[model samples]
Target chain A: MTIRTTLSAGLAAMSLTATLGASTALADPVTVGLITTLSGGGAGLGVDIRDGFQLALSMSGSDAIHLVVEDDAQRPEQAVQIADRMIQSERAQILTGIVWSNLAMAVVPSATAQDVIYVSPNAGPSQLAGAGCTPNYFNAAYQNDTMHEASGAYANVLGYENTFIMAPNYPAGIDALTGFKRYFEGSLAGELFTQLGQTDFAAEIAQIRASGADSIFIFEPGGMGISFMRQYAQSGIDLPIISAAFSFSQDVLPAVGDSALGVINTAEWSPDMDNAANQAFVAGFQEAYGRLPSVYAAQAFDSANLILSALAAADINDLPAFRTAMRAADFDSVRGAFRFGNNQHPIQNYYAREVVSVDGVLTNRMVGTAFEDHQDVYATDCAME
Target chain B: MTAALFLEQVLNGLQLGLMLFLMSAGLTLVFGVMGLINLAHGSLYMIGAFFCAAAAAASGNFWLGLIAGTAAAAAAGALIEVTVLRRLYDRDHLDQVLATFALILVLSELTKIGFGPFPLFLDVPPILSGTVNLGIAHYPLYRLALIGFGLAVALGLWLLIARTRLGIRIRAGENDREMIAALGVNIRALYTLVFALGAGLAGLAGALVGAVQSVQVGMGEPVLILAFVVIVIGGIGSIKGAMVGALMVGVIDTMGRFLLPRLFGHFMEQSQAAGIGAALASMLIYVLMAAVLVIRPKGLFPAHA
Candidate 1:
């Protein structure tokens, strides 16, 4: 009776191992946690990122990846809490989709420390790219300063000498101005640091007028940009404005109305980019969400495809192999020709796009290239162990 | 700064002050008459902007949108007074605060659901689209119109409060609610009327500002904080105090933002000075409020005293 029982137990164990081996041969499931701002002033950006990522995921038709999403409401503390819950309870091995730089600063360090992979779709604060860089972290978006640097480079191209510059007083805001000044060859007419979340720009506009600047370079994003553009238009101080795409992106151009027309802005991706991958992304995104995708959405789509490409090559359980796959970044990016630098941030092209009315719908068209194969200045500072 | 620049800054200050008065007037009136701290005043302001944007898009007339917004806010005020605020009159301030805070959440979510998460476009009317020659500076005609509208509303409010029979009952209720009830006056209806009137004024301010600023969710709370400061400085429940306090706060805030950075620039690098100046300027209004509170604990124009 004992010999018969041992033989039956061995048979059952063999069947269980066979089933596990077959499953491994087929595909290994990956859980991804997406924490983004979904219910506040910044909700528009988050919604675009979420819809873009979901569109990429659904198009891939790979049931191997499971996604869990939560709203951070644009708060750092809330983002931290969500990251904790996703890591511990949901067991999300991969995390992505943070919109604001401040919130990313709060969540990314500890998350990477816990051995979880964080592929940033947006919000690449300079700290993560420099000495604080981690091995497991990858930035699918440009560093925070890179877009602003593009504007600075384009400003030189446009011969904007004695330009008046303004930004809100915060870490990212400071980075924006610093980045612009790094590449700008001309002297500044005026530099003003306005209060964050300031809606009224009348005082600043008056200062700009009195500054005798030839052009204006502002970095006010979201609704602040809408307010500034409207007020600036009414003030009749049209000195040819240039800014990063954060202010002039598709998500905000509609609210900005005719005032945004002909404005030159710098970005890594535009809807009018002439590439098969980009055209497909723009068409698929609009058909799926009924609105043009912003640069944030394009970045998020790339981040998801990046993950999928890595997953297809290596199992998530094999951490070293998966990291190597992600580093390779073997995927067709909507922005075209995307790859990671030594710091794991994207080294790509930045273009200057002009806001134009396309069939009465406001969108951007590529006008010029700002930077070719641009890498972040801080890449040399990253001592990745 | 040049004289033209200074004049432009002053006009900017006046415009900001007048808008604050419109917001503070309603807040003060409700507090004085009902003895209820209505924290949801900002939510009403948001509702006004949303309704105005929607109505303006449908009608293509800013005037129609303005009327629709004002009426909607008044109606919302009346409904809220009858349903939720009536029971809270005798309750503690904490309970009133909690309930009204909840209303903010509910109203904000409902607005988001109705308007989606994006800001709506609302441009200045054609007649008020260009700049006006103000001798020293060319100012936006819509802003000058806003100043004129705000002043007209102030005058109208003063006449209504000082001359009308309804105003007499409102003053009486503020002094002695029990006495007004004993004098065969319908206190419940008066409360609703005052609340609705206050709400209408707030709505008007919101609709006007929405054309200049982005018409989006959570726009009201920042303005609401400044309104509270204005009332506290002017003395709660006093419309005259609200007017004086609003103007002072607005001018100080605008001037602080304009001058503080330049002041620091004389001693420090321009960029460093500008940063420090802006940091201090944001604190200027709160500093002014604290100073006022220290000197006049009851406020500049306390209704009771």
Candidate 2:
């Protein structure tokens, strides 16, 4: 009787454990945790990267990345919470997608500490581009200061005497101002750093109106840009409102409508760039979402391109090689040329652009070159020997 | 600065104040009556704006879309109250916060799934497209109309609460829900009505502001927080207080942003003055809020049933 009972217990244990584990292990897909600001003011950018990443993944015909999505809600604490769950509980092998620098900073350190690789589709903060740069961290987008520095250089070429500089007050805002000052050596009529995500700019506009500046350079992106531009136009300030890449996002232009026309911005790429890559990307994006792709979307696409190349180079079956290959910056980006700076930040050209209304469709088109081989200034200060 | 410039800035303040009133009213009322701190309130505002834009573009009539947007928000508010919020009413505030926070996630993703994450604009009607003269100041006619419309709403809400049986029930509920329920009132129905009313107000606010601003996802959130700040300063659960608080907050925020830096310029460098003043001005509302909290924890004009 004892022998028979032991045999039954052994059979039951096998039934409950070994066979089940074998089947489950081979069937479940490798999950990638895509953390983003899927809600709040940053939702537009989150969705852009979402669509672009999804499209690029589909085009690659690889089932290697099974996304376990979490919306950070544009909160730093929530992003860390989501990252913890994704890493330990959801068992997401790789992490990607963050639109804001503050949030990326919150999540990346945690992910890196766990020895998990994080791929940033956008938001390469200078600190990340410099000293805090990690081997496990690779960014597929432009560094935060690169484009703004380019804008400042172009404003210098335009030869404006009295210029005004404005940015949302934060680390990135300060970075933008620092970057702008690196290239723009002219006298600043006034420097106004306002609160982040401020919807109304009446007070700031009042300040600008009184500054008596010849040119106005600003770094308010997404919905904030629309609010500022609309209010600026209505105030009849009559100065050129310059911007970083964000003023011309697919998220902002529609809000301003005709008010956005003639606004000059600076970026590496625009939908109306008239390049083969730009035209193709714009066409594909419009066909899918029925709207032009913003710079964020373009970066997302570039991220996918880089990721795919890295995956192929590493031979996905080998995770170590995949990490090694990603460290190498495998593919050429959509922006004509790109190379990883010593700190792994991107070195790329920047273009000055204008929003034009052609046949009722409004988008930014490249008007002039701003800076070439433009490196973020803080890279020189980085002690990443 | 010239008087004309100052006059123009004042006009801009009024425009901003009116927009704040639209958002703050519903929020103040929701807090006052329902006694629930809802973070997802902004998501409902976004839903209204999105529906207004889509419907207006489809039907080619802005007015009809505005109506639909109101109804849709009412329906959504009722639905959320019934399905999710009802369960949370008796729970801890933290539970309600967490659950509603989750609701924001659901609503935002659903919006992306439905509207595909693109920002849209609602056009000002042709009749109100141009600027109108106001004491040597040119104002956008649409903006003026918004102020008129907000005043009408304030008046309408006043009459609805003061002159109607529903208002009595709401007041009664705010005073003592158990008493109202024991007195044979259909408390569930009353809650539904209040929730729907608050939601409709929020929707109307979103749609109205949609004309001047972009109708985009999550657009309602920043304004929603400010509205809470408004009610807190004015006194919770009082419509009159909401109106007063909103206008006060708006006017102070606008005027301080404009005037404070100049005031500082007398002693400091122009750039230093602007910087110091701008930083201080941003905090002025919070400072006012803290002072209010010190004086009246319940609010400035606490509602007595």
Candidate 3:
């Protein structure tokens, strides 16, 4: 990933020098401008996306494809700055990668406005799935809230009547909360919205203890989820925690330990998934990276696969045909199957999963398929004709 | 709301406040004495969490992990103070900020390299894991323990500052540096020890928090920012200030997040209420800090001698 980033950085640096200090600038490669939070706490996902994309490129025999990767450093406005340079200056036709919904929102509109194709690897903002959906914007991932909504349905089926929801105060949080409520026929005893990236959830958990919330549905991802889950388990409530997919993914499974054992999560990807593409992707990813692939990797792989198949079927150099072919490609997804929605987001299945023992080792696996091609609630607002 | 529900929320808020105090007291002390704004203090907190998780996992004992995690932070802090920060005492805040920011990158990456990018979990001891019925509501025993633990640290800090030679030296350092150095205090060692002590406090907070949370790279930063806010409101370098600031911030934050949306709901749509309430709740601490700054400039409990 660093190699690709450095190579992109090298290209960008060269182009920058040429733009400022030359007339002999001739060798400008296909610059794929990438923006994501590559620093701060969320850097975990950012690094994974960066490395996953680079690995795909490497496996496909390309690095000088000129990826002008820039770190938002987890800052939203900074992402805009990087996007601007990538478009006007780097002459990038395609923009790829964003880890945060806020950052994605910042970069995607700008990319689409310039008629540039933006391939989103991480954040699938509900706005993009609905009224804000655009032909120029393509999500290589599931909408943010679909996975949690799936969890909610499973929990509802399991007979959890009172569920409490907590999430960071951000657009993605709202999406996840909405999703949970959609399928979770239970009464929300209370919903706690916190600052994005908040470390402590003790106060909220304590409040929940008294709320008589039979089940807790939380959507905190990354380090925050780890803290909340461990604490929740430590709280000795014994309430089943139906979680959004990101909360207990590969990135955090080990961190949360045995406490994460019964954590039923909902997501589109899991290593133990019963599918040929997924099996292949998991094995290959582990072999290549020396660790199991998280959902982010699967999402990136599918995105690249879609891109490859689209480029192959249509005139690779023709932008309009490429976009049309991609929209119609119905590419082989690792998540069994999915199709692009009219809004350029995916109408895909979400799964109900639990961390179960695989050969005496614990890891999350799919228990049941929950929501089928679940559309975002905000899709109604997405005014794309 | 029922009395139990309200009582539970208050306890929850205090637990949150104590956790904040654990981080902010050290931060405020460091700021008061050194005038260095460390953006990477969170990294040290993360270190403690990672260490505690690893130690507890390796030892199968939560207490040992807690101690080891605290020690690990102290050692790391001492090392950083000696190797990196010692050179920066003469530099400006921008330089200090940049250097510490870079340290965050190095430390987070280093943690990733060491621990592998998977999140690590620490288990609460069985005895501490159960919940207690507080007359009206069931609350986690561990959270109550955290509040107790935080109080112990606060009292311990107060006693140390008021009754010990080292504490007096630290107080002296906060007031005058050259005079203290002239008085034959090993100012260098004092700084290292103080930094390490502060780091240890941050680490203890990390380890304590780790039992409830996932331990991963860059886990300490959000708490670190809030810690800064705590100290800023409490007055830099004052332990009492940190306590008051932490409690105020935690209670306000907790209540605002819980009640503000409902309050706003009375005047607006549900979604709009939630959005406005959540945003306001998160920003409320900062708003409070700004207000205090406007009135007092030096914060509520200024550390000035």
- Model 3: lDDT to the true structure: 0.80
Q: In model 3, what is the error at residue B195, expressed in angstroms?
A: 1.8
Better of 1 and 2 by lDDT: 1
For candidate 1, write residues A218-271 as lDDT tens digits: 999988999999999899777999999999998889889999999999999999
The DockQ scores of all candidates, in the order shown, are 0.76, 0.37, 0.51
True contacts kept of 1: 0.66
Off by over 4 Å in 1: A1-28
Residue B210, candidate 1: how far off, in angstroms? Answer: 0.6
What tens digits encode model 3's per-residue C-alpha lDDT throughout A296-347? 8777777766766675566535778879988884566788877876677777
Question: Which candidate leads the pack in lDDT?
Answer: 1
Judge the docking of candidate 3 as incorrect, acceptable, medium or high. Answer: medium
**Residue B59, model 2: Cα distance from true site in angstroms:** 2.9
- lDDT measured at residue B212 in model 2 versus the true structure, 0 to 100: 60
Give all candidates' CA lDDT scores: 0.92, 0.78, 0.80
Residue B67 lDDT (model 1): 92
